[model samples]
Target: MAELQIAEIPYEDGGIRYRYARRLSEDGTRWIRDGRFTAYHPNGAIASEGTYSDGIEQGLWRDYHDNGRIAAEGQYDRGQESGVWRYWDSDGRDVNG
Candidate 1:
């Protein structure tokens, strides 16, 4: 199996930033973003966490508010959302129904 390779640089835009890492194809022609990923708010606090496979988002994912509170949680299947999803307020109250 190929080992995961991190992006050469971090992505930043609109006060958000994140990094992506993935494995390189045997031909080295394509760099896929696989493994763990995280995004941060402008204040440098973590805004989200998730996993990806073959360049597509997968598995459990969590997004947080700028104040360090979880804003949402759910599962993903190859970048498509799957299973139950929940949302929370900045105060940490579950608002998902």
Candidate 2:
């Protein structure tokens, strides 16, 4: 794993923007903010992910779908969802939308 840092990266296949990425942690480790993350696709589409701090979902958070919809999302709060949370279906569609 690489050290955490704030930097911009390209999508997994260089299709879109992937910013602020950090190394994935161990199973027991919690996601924290050092300004790092990634956005990718399972089949093909957008998916963002990351961590967050100060009640904000920060770092490496991703959102998108394999069918060009919304698949799901990412979290790193070390706790439950709070303050401005969103949900999506398996196809990456927003539930609230």
Candidate 3:
């Protein structure tokens, strides 16, 4: 049995700034996302955060505005959006209502 090795990759978009950091695991065949994932805004603020299982999104996920306020949040099941999702404005006010 081959031990799964995790790799951390930091990516930059257009050579401007860091875009996202992803963790991938090799399953003896191919590399797939299998851990925490975080994306950043061009200004360095976190744009989104979530987790993945075998390249499929799973569990809670949150997206933020460039100003650092929560923009949206919800759950993911097998890479599909699940349950009720909440949204907020850049000022942090809930936009669902």
Candidate 4:
């Protein structure tokens, strides 16, 4: 099996600033970035994922719990939350809107 590929930039405070990953294409090409961005938790679980434009977060972004369940989900405009947002518990129950 082929291993997944990821490229990451770190913040000055030792957190991730941005990250990009390789994904297989419809035509079988390996592409990096491809619009989706991800950050990892200290335990290596996905902390958040969303689209970016010019280094700013855009579109839908989802944050996850340490147990791997979605904790919150919402849309973003230039790294700011925009539109209606929702929150969920680790058991997948909607806790907020």
Best by lDDT: 1
Identify the runs in model 4 with alpha carbons over 4 angstroms from their true place. Answer: 1-6, 9-18, 21-34
Task: Give the better candidate number (2 or 4) by lDDT.
Answer: 4
**Tens digit per residue, CA lDDT, model 2, 1-97:** 4456565556567555645544445553654344534555544355666555432454335466566555544454544543455768875457866
lDDT (Cα atoms) of all candidates against the true structure: 0.85, 0.53, 0.75, 0.76
Put down candidate 4 lDDT per residue, 1-97, tens digits, no spaces: 2344567877666777568755554455655344678887766678888886544678999999877999999998877999989999989899984
TM-score per model over all chains: 0.82, 0.37, 0.74, 0.62
Report the poorest 10 consecutive residues by lDDT, candidate 3: 15-24
Q: Kindly provide the TM-score of model 4 when superposed on the true structure, using C-alpha atoms.
A: 0.62
Worst 10 contiguous positions by lDDT, candidate 1: 7-16
Clashes of each: 1, 21, 0, 0
Whose TM-score is greatest here?
A: 1
How would the candidate models be sorted by lDDT, starting from the highest? Answer: 1, 4, 3, 2
Sort by TM-score, best first.
1, 3, 4, 2
What would the C-alpha RMSD of candidate 4 be, to one decimal place?
8.0
Model 4 accuracy (lDDT, Cα): 0.76
Candidate 4 residue pairs in clash (backbone atoms < 3 Å) = none
